[model samples]
Target: MKAVVFSRYGGPEVLEVRDVPEPKLGPESVLVDVRTVSVNPVDWQIAAGHLDSRFDVRFPVIPGWDVAGVVAEIGPTVTEFAVGDEVIGYVREDSIGRGTYAERVAAPLRTVARKPMNLGWEQAAAMPIAGLTAYQSLVRTLRVGPGDTVLIQAAAGGVGSFAVQIAVAMGARVIGSASDRNHDYLRQIGAEPVAYGPGLNECVRALTPQGVTAILDMYGGQTLTSSLDLLSDESKGRVVSLTNDGILEQGGTFVFARPSKADLDQLTRMAESGVLTPEISTVMDVTDAAEAFRLSQTGHVRGKIVLRVMGRLSAAIH
Candidate 1:
């Protein structure tokens, strides 16, 4: 199998494309013939060694988590899927040694589900990590509900795009922050776009004068702190950050959306039905995966970046 592997954590230049032995499938795993894999900030973060504490990577790591592929073989214990069944999911960060930046990967059954029938391989690959995180943060952690007003930072980005759509589908009035260029796209996806700038707090307040019921801060540093101050009552507003800045404040909640098979299944359904759609900024060859990592680190991507692993599946939903 040809894979993008890095012997050590440093920069994108450290990544190299090489022929590596195929992964060994476990009793509870399925071998996926990878078609596409999306790039997330976590991918680059791990490659740059920023998440060393959270995940200890074995040397020569393949750096991708989101995978969309067909089951080439099934584990002895796996009964949910069979060979040729299309699936998508995020790989365990600790299991980067068997990562998705390759022609094929063996992933635990618990982390994967059948790919949405309405999504292409690229779109399916884009959903797992980012979409699940947004869904969990809003629906599970923040408890956003109908008649609620929710603000999502970086709305044009990967997680933000899904958050906006999912929140709207849940009947919450959503306000999203992005640059001027993304505002139109965000609006089309059912979010009231707010151009983030000098006084983004006031901008949010102006849009939802009654005050936001919840805020999911994908941009943590200043965006989150400002969101905290915009709350009319702390109880009505729940702020959740993907960052570990400790800014949830007294009587508030901070969440790191943990991966869950159940959550991925829900996201997959929402995507297939068109209630949620993933925005992909670019697609690169597997060999150019290192460049994809660099793009993700810039933090300016309007949507998800994906690595092309193989030909699109004819049966894949598009």
Candidate 2:
């Protein structure tokens, strides 16, 4: 198997494609021949050693989470899928190494879901992490619904794109924060766009003096503080965050994406029904992971950055 691995924590420059041992199959896992994978902030963060305190760093770490692939082999105890079944997964393990950034990966049954038929390989590969983040943030944590006005930070990015659509589908009025260029794009996704910057709180206030009934902060730092400041008294428990757990102290819910087959099924149903769609900003070959990581680390992409892992297609889109 060929995998992109970094022998030590460093920059994207440290990543290299090399032949490596195939992941050992488990009784509860399936071996997938990777078709596509998506680059996420956590992939580069773990590569750069930012998550050292939280997870043990293993040498030759394979950094990736989202995957869309065909099942090459299924474990003896895994009855949910069979050989050649199309699947998608959030292939996160307890440690940081051995991931989907390769030609193949052994994914646990718990993290895999049937690929949404409405999506292509690139689109399907882009869903798991960001889709789950948005699903958990709005449905599980924020409980957004009718008559509620929800404000979502980083509204044009991967998770925020999904969050905006899901909130709108749930009957919540969505106010999204993005750059001026993405404001129109946000409106197309059913969110009322607002420019995010030094005057974000004031701009939001101008939109609705009563303040937001719920807030989901996908971007941390300034956005987290701004989200806290924008929350109405009625939104005490309606606030959710994907990047900051500190929101819990302010009566908000801090969400870490969980691998749930049920959630994937729901997201699949929504996509099939035309209520949700993934916005992909870039696609590159698996061999181009270093460059893809560079683009993802910039934190300015409008949506997801995907790597086409299999097939004759080797491309990059900005």
Candidate 3:
């Protein structure tokens, strides 16, 4: 199998293409011919060794979490899936051992979900991590509901786009923060967009004089701190973050995305029904994965950046 792997962590330069052994299938695993995979901030963060203390990944790791493909072979114990089933899901962190920047990956049964038949591979690949984070952030951690006011930071980002749409579909009044360039785009997606620049907190205050009912902070640093101050005293106002999990004592929930087959399955169904959609910025070949990782780390991506795996999978969604 051809893959992009690196023995060390540093920069995009460290990622290299190589011919590697195919992953050995487990009794409960399915061998997928990966047609598409997307890059996330976690990919670059893990690659740069920023998560070494937490994830504890060994050297020579292949970095990717979101995968979409056809099941080429099913394990003996697998019953829900069969050969030629189209699937998509967030691979468990433990399976980061083999990685997804390759032609094939053997994914555990619990982590995989049926892909939406109507959606293309690029969109399916982009949905897992980003979509799950958005779903869990609003529906699980924050409990967003009708008439609620939600302020989503980085509203034009990978997770942020999903958060905005899901909050709107739930009947919540959504306020999104992003740079001026994305303001119009955010508004088109059912969010009341706010310019995220100097005095961003003041801008948000001006938008909602009653104070926001909830906040989904996908960006850490000052963005998280700003959200902590913008919450109303009522318990209805809570802050949920995917990038930060520290210093929240003011009745706000701190959150991190955990992969779940049930959540992925629900999200895929939503995508197929057109209740939710994955926004894809660009799609590139796996051999150009370094470029995809570079684009993801910029923090300015309007949506997900996907990598189209080759050879083992068919030619699609390039």
Using TM-score, give the best candidate's number. 2
**Per-candidate clashes, comma-separated:** 1, 0, 0
lDDT of model 2 at position 200: 88
Q: After superposition, how far is residue 160 of candidate 2 from its true place, in Å?
A: 0.5
Q: After superposition, how far is residue 248 of candidate 3 from its true place, in Å?
A: 4.2
161 Cα displacement, candidate 3 (Å): 0.4
Using lDDT as the measure, name the better of candidate 1 and candidate 3: 3
User: After best superposition, candidate 3 residue 260: deviation in angstroms?
Assistant: 0.9
- State each model's CA lDDT, in order: 0.82, 0.88, 0.83
TM-score of each: 0.93, 0.95, 0.94
Top candidate by lDDT: 2
Error of 1 at 233 (Å): 0.7
Could you tell me how far off, in angstroms, the CA of residue 298 lies in candidate 3 after the best superposition? 1.8
Off by over 4 Å in 1: 93-96, 234-237, 248-251, 311-318
- Give lDDT tens digits, candidate 3, residues 1-318: 677788897998898877678889999999998899999988888888888777767667877878999999999999999999999978865534578887888898888999998899999999998898899989987878997899998999999999998899888999999989998889888999888867888888998887888888876787677666777778443788676666365455676678788999889778877878888899888878778888877789998998888662223223
Per-residue C-alpha lDDT of model 1 across residues 200-269, encoded as one tens digit per residue: 8888878877788888887667667667777657444477787754764645566655667889999988
